[model samples]
Target: MASNRIRKSALPGFRFSIGFTILYLSLIVLIPLAGLVVKTAGLTFPQFWETVTSQRVLASYRVSLLTALFAALVNVVFGLVVAWVLVRYRFPGKKIIDGLVDIPFALPTAVAGIALTSIYAPNGWIGRLLDPLGIKVSYTPLGITVALIFIGVPFVVRTVQPVLQELEAEMEESAALLGAYRWRTFRKVLLPELVPPLITGFALAFARGIGEYGSVVFISGNMPLKTEITPLLIITKLEQYEYSQATAIALVLLIISFALLLLINTLQRWTNRRLRSA
Candidate 1:
């Protein structure tokens, strides 16, 4: 009876489907990553170390990691606020504002760079006002942060927005009945439900910011050891035909990114488990 059930429930051509899935993954993901590893492996340990640890490369790493972290953190705060506002309230031009949230997803990175450059240049409208106060936005590290924030904001907003929309108001009402303050209620009730999505968004934004190029290039001024980013450094290596060096740096970034993402996933799981137990 068990054998008969198994035979009857089997998908037609399951073997072929499974084989194609494996082949497709190999062709699309594994093969390219393998090629990258192979190329990076061509370098000796000292060479790889030197390539990834050059003063310029180290500086780029600092800039990239810090700016990305800053951007992600900024997104976590403001994205939550934006998502909350959108989900809980009605306001003027609400539909237009909702549509605007997706602009980053549709806009080209290079175009974003150009547009930001134009708006934030010293002579530009906003820049002109800030320039007198001794603030520089374009062609600086701050500009890089702004560009990253621009592109990364959507990830956090979109991730948290749906979760916020699905959340019932009854929880807030219950907390209020229990004499909880507004902040306490949100912190205890809403935040736990939002934490998983928030972390996921932060990770996505952080990862994307690490590799961001076009949106940063125009604003960063590409000043090595100053405003340069790791992705730009990688591109420079490739342009100089230092293929092995580029691959080595890329490999290092890949490893670090993977480890960080894994750590985030572990933390998320732990948080979920604790929440469930509570």
Candidate 2:
């Protein structure tokens, strides 16, 4: 008696594919990060501590973190509303409106910075109107938040849009039939389903804003210890030929970002688990 055996495809074996994937990731991601860590190693403990914990550096971190958080929060609310409208309603210029959501995605960061600066500058059209009220938009912390919001809005919109489309109308109908009011239905049924994607989008936008330079630099006025952001501080360090100090600050930023992302992931997982159990 003889037996026949099936063999896997030979075009690309699993082992070969995985090996290539690891190699690609190492070359593109891990290696550069390792280099950064190594460069930062050149700094003494006191030097590294001084570089990252200085008042100016601390202020930049505070501004960057707060602005990013505020922007991400704003996006979460508006993004959900936009996604819901697009998913549930039909109107004139619907396609055009949908296309407009992606404009930020296509716009260059520097161009966005310049455009925002012009519109918000004291003598510019909109700014001129607000100037009488003493509402300064450009060259301030508020301006940085505006820039982050501009660049971050699309992330939330795009993330939540597909989820909205896939949500069954029957669910809403069932909730209404069960005497759930609109707000109650949304809070109890729709919002839970949206949470995971919303959190993911928030994390992405926050991360992007933390590292954002081009769009924020012009609008923020790059005033050290005031409106300056961490990226600009990093650039300033480089300009002054403080390579070790720059890398030290970069290392601190990398660590903090990694920790924040990990925390967000943990919270997302917990929310998902609670949703499933409910």
Task: Give the lowest summed-lDDT range of ten residues in model 2.
Answer: 1-10
Lowest lDDT 10-residue stretch of candidate 1: 269-278
lDDT top scorer: 1
Clashes of each: 0, 0
Alpha-carbon lDDT, every model: 0.89, 0.88
TM-score of each: 0.90, 0.88
Stretches of candidate 2 exceeding 4 Å from the true structure = 1-9, 13-24, 263-278
Model 1 RMSD in angstroms = 2.7
RMSD of each: 2.7, 3.6
Can you write out model 2's per-residue Cα lDDT over 34-126, one digit (the tens) per residue? 999989888788888988999999998999999999998999999888888988899999999899988888999999999999999999978
What pairs collide in candidate 1?
none
Q: What lDDT tens digits, residue by residue, belong to model 1 across residues 201-271?
A: 89988988998898999989989999999988888999999888889889988998898789778856765
